[model samples]
Target chain A: MAQLTFRESIARGIAQEMRRDESVVFLGEDVGAAGGVFKGTVGLLEEFGGIRVRDTPISEQAILGAAMGAAMTGLRPIAEIMFSDFFAVCWDIVANEIAKSRYMTNGQMSFPLVIRSGNGGGLRFGAQHSQSVENWAMMIPGLKVVVPSNAVDVIGLMAASIRDNDPVVFLEAKSLYSSKMDVPDGDIVDTLGSAKVLRQGSDATLVALGAMVPRALDAAEELATNGINCTVVDVRSLVPLDTATILREVSATGRLFTVEENPRLCGWGAEVTSIVADEVFYDLDGPIVRITTPHIPLPAADALEDLAIPSVERIVTTIHKSMNS
Target chain B: MASTKVAPAQSDVAQKIAMYKSQFALRQFETRAYDLFLENYVKGTSHLSIGQEAIAAGVAAAMRPTDWTFATYRGHAHTLARGVPMTPVFAELMGRTNGLMAGKGGSMHLTSVEHGVMGSYAIIGAHLPIACGAAWSAQYRGTDQVAVAFFGDGSVNIGAFHEALNFAAVWKLPVIFFCENNLWMEYTRTSDVTAVVNPAADRASAYGLESIIIDGNDADEVYEVTSRAIARARAGDGPSMIEAKTYRHGGHSRADPGKYRPAEEIAEWMAKDPIPRYRLRLLESGVSESELLEIEAQVNAEVDDATEAAKAGGVPGEDLLMKDVWADGGAAWRN
Candidate 1:
């Protein structure tokens, strides 16, 4: 019933979960006293106290490892790794320990941990702080990777991630943190591995995720004005991808354009394109197109960063090219 | 949970030494278990702690059953000393259905939750952060239980080690980072790679931690220092870094013979062998030779029994290869 930004929705989701379940706790740099660098956890510390809302040292490995241990023992820890790039510092713990714990111990252990981090390259945070590392997580077997596009989806996805019995990598796009939307009142629980179709059309299907989802919607609207009705689906979850929905949409449109902010090579978009091509090749009228950032490190310069990332215009162009080809 | 006071034994030094010999019996049990693995009765690579028996026996003697511990690849000594039954540990190494991890984890990755031995990781320095997390949990739950992480010197140089220590120091987690500086990281000498030559304790100061460099060969010294650190951690003082300066008589793995070490250095360390050193000390402190021989015979019989039991327990079933790949929820997306 109330309008809230994506960032505020996440904070409310975490706060509600922490209140309902005493096992839920927050840990990360600047998450407690400072309410996180982006203010997503602004008032949590004051409400939960230092024990529940902890300000951890700037050690990504320990932050993740500690979360894994706590999750295995009995606590559900929502750990924040300031930036997605810093995830590399603790990949071994994430991939080897947390992800594989449930399987490695033969179902004796379950890592019910939620690892939240900011990703994407819209802001000039440079190569170190920027870049979408969801593809790396998608490569891992046991992890469930989610990247929500708006306030409503963020709230829903965050709750699902917290409730998941396995480890989940929740990537919050920094560019979409301040974006506002009117979310429905009462509790909202969304299912994992499901996609949302924002716009319905028959001309082409546009698959996108995170910050790129909004851009694809805008592109769909612009194309609608010209009678080129394009369908836009927000792939909120990456690892357990809703291929069933994606395939049905692509089969109807006969043209596909996958959009992502990550580099083109081995990106999430590439994987989606491959899956669609392999499964529904005969249904497609033309070759699948992927609109993504160039395969290079993100630059600090504004103009270069803007040019490097996919835009609405790029999505529209990619859609037209796929239709024409 | 209320604190349980476990006072240190105040009997004569001879009695303490005898208790430690019982702890060594567990390590000897694992050593003989390795023989089953070596004789092809069990499958998978095995890393035995045949020579470094005192380190595990002494450290675990000072720890309570509730305290948490994690070890590296060469973890049989730590697991045995931490009170995991010899049968399951050997069965896990042999990949049996009744193994500690249900045949999912092999030699390098053995875990027993009942014993508070969380698990042993094969990756260098990877478990340091996990150990810190366990310690944090204990402190958060208002428990006085301490967490100990045992790693070789090679792990001290990894990024995870630095990150884990920095976090442990900042949060003052109840943890004891025990570094076994066995003078070598695989084939390379510690001097050839590490910038700090004194010991891992010297580097602890950089992280603002209280460090103690003890003669790891002397079991009594290890027990005394570790007991103090554990006590300090239980009292909420903070984490401590301990550099147990010791040596490995065997090679890094079963394949290598440790031919890289100088004969003179090996002889020098062998002269201060921990088992013999403790044995002599016990004999001089009023323990009779007959009692020592009795202890040895008892341990030898236990080792023989463990080996026989492990050999009788066969390898895991073929259908179990894909059993533990994921939790019982559902299949994970492979694409």
Candidate 2:
């Protein structure tokens, strides 16, 4: 086993895909010489020539449009949108064109493309730059949304996303980009839509997404010391949500708490809450709780941003409240 | 394919006449489609390509059959010119089960992978970057297939148009930006809204691309201009643009009568209509009048048959709403 930072694992994962599939090419702003804003693409330009790793003008529409068009033909283009917030600039293309073209084309074309974007809010990049709007993308019907927690999951899930026969938006947690984690020694590919049970317990189930997974684990470990053991599962991909694992965990514990950075109302947490409400409501011994940020734009200040996001303390508090109430 | 260049002689003349006949067929098709839409036989509206047949027919003829094409809402002529079956084209507008898109895409979203009509975007200039992507794919896959993006004068002002052209030029993708400068961008004149005198080629040149302005109403000129660009792209010389000065005869949609257009301007363009002008060119060039009439009669019959078949076709099944929404994900992918 080798320890790798989240960003390094991303570079390794994409480099592996590009080596495996010639059709896989990387394109975006600062993806080339600048090696990506967070250095996720630090060594890609050297490994792959300019033809494969291109630095595009700051046009997200063109980037995504090219990805959609290339996917329609034979190329598997991995476009980086720099930040998930920039998805708004090409909102129509992402929401309307790329997401709907396959179904609109009647399964005649499989959009085998990946859009890697930096998401989440811990760094205090302010309102526009720091927003977790995976829920907005998840609302679109024909999209596959993936958000990984660690280096191992990021590498495997990214490779899987590149090979997926559908359009995928893989949002990397900017907060965890430098965080180091041990990944498997050799080649490892993770299955999409499969949730991993990071910890097991019977008191309650804590299903989280993106950076929230580590935080959920943190809360679980703290709860473990207090004798309130909990099960923690990384509900990785929201679109092809591992509802089977989610239902099983919730069924076993008779309680469900979804942790996320997005706002509470109608966010991804609501989707999980509704699913549990519909399918496994009888299995729950208590009401479903969602530990999420308030429904407001992310603040620029460090203190306010910290308070706005779902911290480990907040998840622990929500867990205890859900356990009792 | 035989040399795309058209000369004043035997087989070349025959190819020219073939293009002429195709333009006539598209003209007839658009006319009949508009009539059906007026009669309410075809559901929804259509942006007919009545005056812009030459650009469509010429560009489609200039490229290889395998080459991809993208267009805007005014794409019935484009699909027809690209050789999509008239039955499916008509059926698509009529929302039939056997339509080009299984009745899902309708007029604005008409598409056919087999015939190489990638998409007919309703949003102006939105498909430009997508067209660039197709070109990038062809280069990446090492295929000589070139993708053409067809849009109007209004699209030239949009950011996507600029973005796409820059990307195409920077990447040297095998794509052609065919600007159908039809003067009017849905009732508003191109000059009224745009900054330049003729928006054609100016935008392309801004992106450091080789561009040319041709008489869009002339089928032969369009074929010649687009053929050179496509050949250049195939030779790996990169992207080029052809701004074809064309006009739209009908109003923007079924609703508009186009009172905003000056009578003289519309009259001047109507005199410059591509079909009759090309017909005269063919006849003066020693092609018999009977040949032209025969082509017209044949297309007329084809349009009638298509209209009848489309009206007689069955509606989309109930599962239309449920199926094809998620090709590879959405719960089915869960393990």
Candidate 3:
């Protein structure tokens, strides 16, 4: 096993897939020689050569359109949209073309492509760059949404996204790029629709995705000392949701708390809360609570940004208050 | 700008006859589609390629079977030209069980990969970059196949059009961006909306490509020009932009009466209808009138057979609604 940062794991995971498949090619702005805008793709250009790894212009529509066309033909292309917010510029292509192509074509075309972007806040990049946009992708019917919280999950999920025969929107938490984890050497793959239970508890279930997973875990540890034991469930795949794991954990805990970085309105938490409220209503001992950012733009200031996104302190306080009440 | 492409060979009588048949098939198909729409047999809306058959027929004749073709929402002619059986095309238009896409994609999204009709995109200018991507795949795989995208004059104003042109030029992709300049963008005149006189060809220089314009009503011209462009692409000379000047005899969609056009202008273009002109050319070139009569009879019979077959098809099954949404052939998002 070797210690790899989340950003390093992005490159490692892509390299693992590209090395395995000759048809796999990667492209985006500054993704080739400049090693990606986030420096997550440092060695891909040199290792794979320009043919396999390419740097495109500042054309989001063209980048995604090319990826879709390439995927429809033969190549399994990975196109990076530098920031998750940039999806708005090319939302028509993503929401209309790539998402619906296979179904609209009645399975005549299989889009084995991945569109990865640095998502969510922590760098104080303000509203445009830092806002979590997983909800935008999740609402689309034909897309498979994935967000990995840590280095190991990032590598595993990236591999799964590349291999899957559907169009996948891989959201990399920008906040966790610097975080490190010990990853096993060689190719590591993970299932697309499985949620991982990091901590086992019975009092409450803390469901989180992307950057919120780590915060949920941290809050669980603090809540354990306060006599409020909690279970942390990492929602790795949002589309092919492992509702089995979520329902099982939520049922066991009898109380559900969703830690979301996105805005509160119609967030992923609301859907999960709705599902729990419908399926296992009698199993609940307490009301379900969602801890999320307010329905407002993320601020650029360090203090304001920290307050906007769900932090460990916020998760602990929200869960504790709900449990006590 | 001068046309930089090498002059193409003179089409033989056999090739001319084939082009005539292709155009005849398209004209009949569109005429029948409009009739179906009026009779309420075709639901929603359909954009017909009535007078613009020459561009589609010519491009399809010039293209190899392995080459890919992308068309706009008004793509019935392009789809039919690729030799996708008329019955399935008509069935899709009528939203039948045996439709090309099993009625999943209606008239606007005809896709028959086996026939090299990649797809018919509804969005303006979206398929240009997609065609570039397909060309990129062909190049990457060393397939020597080319991708052709057909759009209207309006798409030139869209962002994707410029981006795709530049991307294809930069990458040296084997793709052709064909613009069927029907002189109007929806209800508006192309000249009133577009800055350049030739929407597509005028912008070719910006992407370091040659500017070439052809008479879209002339099937022979479209076949020769596109053949040259396709050969250049296969030879790895990169992309080409062709603006085929034509006019739509009907409205943009089934709803419009096309009163926006001037009576004189409509009369002028209607006189140059590609079918009759091609027929006259054949007769003047010493071709027997009986030969032309035979082609007309065949096209009429084919259209009749296709319409009958399409009308006989049943509604799609309920299970198909959730199928094909994912690769596993199920739309289950959660367990």
lDDT of 2: 0.87
Instruction: Name every residue pair that clashes in candidate 2.
Output: none
Model 1: lDDT of residue A148: 94
Return whichever of 1 and 3 wins on lDDT.
Answer: 3
- What DockQ do you compute for every candidate structure? 0.53, 0.66, 0.89
Worst 10 residues of 2 chain B by lDDT: B1-10
What tens-digit string does per-residue lDDT give for candidate 3 at A246-303? 9999999899999999998989999999999999999999999999999999999999
Greater-TM-score candidate between 1 and 3: 3
The sequence of per-residue lDDT tens digits that candidate 2 reaches over residues B78-160 is: 98899988999888888898888888788888888888989888888899999999998888778899999999998988888
lDDT of 3: 0.93
TM-score per candidate for chain A alone: 0.98, 0.98, 0.99
Model 2: share of true interface contacts reproduced = 0.71
lDDT of all predictions: 0.83, 0.87, 0.93
User: What lDDT score is found at residue A228 in candidate 2?
Assistant: 87
Ranking by lDDT: 3, 2, 1
- Native-to-model Cα distance after best TM-score fit, residue A114 in candidate 1, in Å: 1.3
Model 1: per-residue Cα lDDT over A48-94, one tens digit each: 99998999877888899889877766788999999999888789999
